[model samples]
Target: MKNKLPLYLLLFFLIIVNAFFLYNYLGAGDQGGPKDQIRPGDFLVKELGLDATQQAAFRTLGREHHRKMRGLLDDIKELKDALFKGLSDDPSHQVNVDSIVHLIGEKEAAKDLEVFRHFKKVQALCNAKQKEKFAKIIEDGLRVGGRDQGPRGARPEGERGPRSKGFEDNRPPRPNGPNANRPPPAARE
Candidate 1:
């Protein structure tokens, strides 16, 4: 009984600690923080330690990326609309359903590529330290819903939470996208 008491107390403590993390992970996680407002310009200016003049130039780059990517999003939305409109009560609609799914997959892939490019742009602006901070922001961002900071199933990379905005994976960071040849440095890394 004495030995059992120690084991039971350890189990109780483990449960308490886990529950605390679970609560924070669920209720007050990523979405409750400033990361929600973090844009490419924010990372370029703050994380990379850029000057005010450089910050202005970086903002232009962010605006351009946003503009180009948003156009792609419009096309993706059109695909979604087509998929929904294809749904008919006819039992022979399987072929249309399959096609819609395939089109959605293509749109999703393109979106993911764009996200990868954005990451590359941001990384080009960073030296080493800023990259670490960018990685932390990404990991934290992935914790938006719950403890699962990864794909639960075999969903497409972009189909996950971050893709709707950006970022395909939330890990130790990868060399996503083609690195920018040269971005005029606003400040030191």
Candidate 2:
């Protein structure tokens, strides 16, 4: 009976551990639901104080915009793939890199245009006060060195001054240091 006691205790401990793990695994599934999840554009909807109809229209617009953007992105990816694949081709059959790059740029431009049009459509949906708010939002977004202008080394208007050491000016200093007025020896070759 004494030897069997340890076996029974071990079985009980394992059952408890298994039950805990099972409970945790099953419990995690219940934590997520449509109501708990924040969907894209929800913030805009809330900020704009859109009516049900407006919200529906906005969602429809978003879906259409996303579909178009996806198509454009896929096209861009295909172009990029062709561009890279051209690297392996025979010298005589080399792809026109510039044309492919131009096409990629055009696709990117179209994406930007699509986004602009989308926002314009959203602006059209707004009432007077909402439109004002939307305009302010857009204005802030477009402002130079604004919140949207992420860490690309762009400083706010007043922060601009004479070039300082350790500041990133987007151009690296010449290898010969600050006093290097002449071109490198390699360039002379």
Which candidate achieves the best lDDT against the true structure? 2
RMSD of 1: 19.1
Q: Across residues 86-147, which tens digit of lDDT does each residue of candidate 1 receive?
A: 66657688888788788878878887898788777766666587778778877776687376
Task: Go through the candidates in order and give each one's C-alpha lDDT.
Answer: 0.70, 0.82
Shift in Å, residue 37, candidate 1: 7.0
Q: Supply candidate 1's per-residue lDDT for 44.
A: 46
Model 2 spans > 4 angstroms off: 1-37, 90-95, 142-189
C-alpha positional error of residue 87 in candidate 2 after TM-score superposition, expressed in Å: 2.6
Candidate 2 whole-model C-alpha lDDT, 0 to 1? 0.82
List model 2 lDDT by residue over 9-120, tens digit each.
Answer: 9999999999999887887667656666666489788888999999999999999999999999999999999999898777765448878898999999999999999999
Residues forming the 10-long window of minimal summed lDDT in candidate 1: 172-181
Give the candidate number with the greatest TM-score.
2
Instruction: Please give the clash total of every predicted structure, in order.
Output: 0, 0
The alpha-carbon deviation from the true structure for residue 165 of candidate 2, after best TM-score superposition, in angstroms, is 10
TM-score of each: 0.50, 0.57
